[model samples]
Target: MERLNKPLTTRQERFCQSFVIYGSGAVAARAAGYKARSSNRQGWRLLQSVRVRERIREIQASLADHRGRANDVIIGKLEMVYHRAMENYQYHAAARAAQMQAKLFQGIEETRAELAAAGIGRDDEDRDRETPNNSPELAGPKMMTFDDNSREIDKACTQMSTWKKRV
Candidate 1:
């Protein structure tokens, strides 16, 4: 669902954007200027719409930029969910949040390794913060192609072998 065949109404568009920002249906609905009395119900109802769901996903993907800061945002949100679930004694929800966090960390580590293999090592990553112009294309976690991913994996294996021999 790239663009909605029929564009969302102004209120629906506002609700979608606000939902992403607030991560709360009722809050987002109110923020979107829905009627206060029925905002809670409308909020959940709006999410049930296929067009609304796709539009929201599209908006979220668009918000993700080349810098990979979206990963940090995702991790932060997961951590917040984990903490809230734990506080409420929702064991299943807390566990799911923790699992998502681990998966995110795995991807981050692989991206760092791939960047390292590309000669933009850890130090270079830090230097890149001060100079954002360097390696703009490779800065994001999802920037690498399948061939590049395969090459990075091979490089990582070779480095692991050298590390074992050094020990």
Candidate 2:
């Protein structure tokens, strides 16, 4: 199962991409063309593979790095805006900047909460906590068919494209 350094088969690549998008083994398996009835089992098995897990981690790390850089730029600009507004004695502008900063902080807080809820940031000893798995980063509509699963993949691609454009 430890084949992370090896080349993946086409189906394996598809499965990895889909899993990265939706974070569901069953949905990703189905989207990768596994039989519907066996998708859950196949997906579970695939997820257990070391190669698959590694690929998923790689994708997530890349996204996180990209997002972190974007956030740094945004926060820097927001800080500048806040200072400029204050220095200009524009109380309304300053208030707006404050609101925007709050909103940005709230967004980060929400993401942190979501990651914690998803069992992502939990330590081994904290794995037994009763928090629900409701991470927005992996949330998607329940996939009833391959089309539904592929839709999530499409959305992920679109999001990456938009992020690149912004960057």
Candidate 3:
């Protein structure tokens, strides 16, 4: 009796069996004594066409469904990580702000203590005179001099020198 799906050839049957076992068209084609390496590429392309593509799509849809369930687990883990990072950032910021405020208050208190120790009240008038002006030239004592005879003496010296040089 003839088989319903008779083998294309004995070699073809062996090629199909080798492909199924090894999952490699190149190996199977070589085993089946196909001359060109491209014959294996064609075999692989044919396996991906039409009926084979539909079957593969079904398997891939099943895998995608499984991955969707795993995505929920990964999202939960990532949310926990996000919340932890935000909490850590907020805690560090609040701690740094508190530390800064404490340092500022401590500096103010020390300044107040120093003022009290020096017997200088905050509104003392002596502090105003003692406050140094920023200008270097205006900070020292001012001097003024008036000499009416100096110009006449300078003119006499100039005329005397000119007369001496000409002689």
Candidate 4:
């Protein structure tokens, strides 16, 4: 007697090949002259026989192993990219903060020179004539503004420290 589960015929072979290549089982079944679309279910069941199932399982296992190795490579590459991007961000942030600090210092120095030129001090050698309650009470507002700016810088530095730790 002929086996009920024999391999596919030439027409069925063409159907399976077209289905796999084009990802359309209906089209494949129509191309194979299967009048009913339900014939695709029969084709699928035949393909899932014991021997075919074992072969499919083995192929899938091999593909999965290869995919695991490829995933490790991809993760390593992505981690390096993340590290480099973080380094660039940190470098630019530090440079910008340094530039701002330098500008603030320049402003302070200019205020000092102005105070010296005005000669409004108890002592000629006193460089801190801008201090509150010191000679030249007019420097109070400028000194208070500078102190506020310094506090803002300190707060910014603290925030950066916290953010760096989290990152």
The model with the greatest lDDT is: 1
Q: Could you give the C-alpha RMSD of every candidate to the true structure, in order shown?
A: 14.1, 19.4, 38.8, 28.6
Q: Per-residue lDDT tens digits of candidate 2, residues 20-101?
A: 7666899999999999999999999988888878888887777655544455445645655655655665545555555676
Which model is ahead, 2 or 3, in terms of TM-score? 2
Model 2 alpha-carbon drift over 4 Å, by segment = 1-4, 69-167
Name the runs in model 4 displaced over 4 angstroms.
1-7, 50-167
Query: lDDT of candidate 2 vs native?
Result: 0.66
Ranking by TM-score: 1, 2, 4, 3
TM-score of 3: 0.23
Ranked candidates, highest lDDT first: 1, 2, 4, 3
Error of model 2, residue 73, in angstroms: 14
TM-score versus the correct structure, for each prediction: 0.47, 0.42, 0.23, 0.24
- Model 1 clashing residue pairs (backbone): none
Candidate 1 least-lDDT 10 residues: 140-149
C-alpha positional error of residue 76 in candidate 4 after TM-score superposition, expressed in Å: 29
Top-TM-score candidate index: 1
| lDDT (Cα, tens digit) per residue for candidate 4, span 1-167 | 43546775676566655554334556666666676757677557535555444444455455445434343333333333333433555533443444444565576568778877899543442334345656555542222233544544454466666774444
RMSD of 4: 28.6
Q: lDDT score of model 4?
A: 0.50
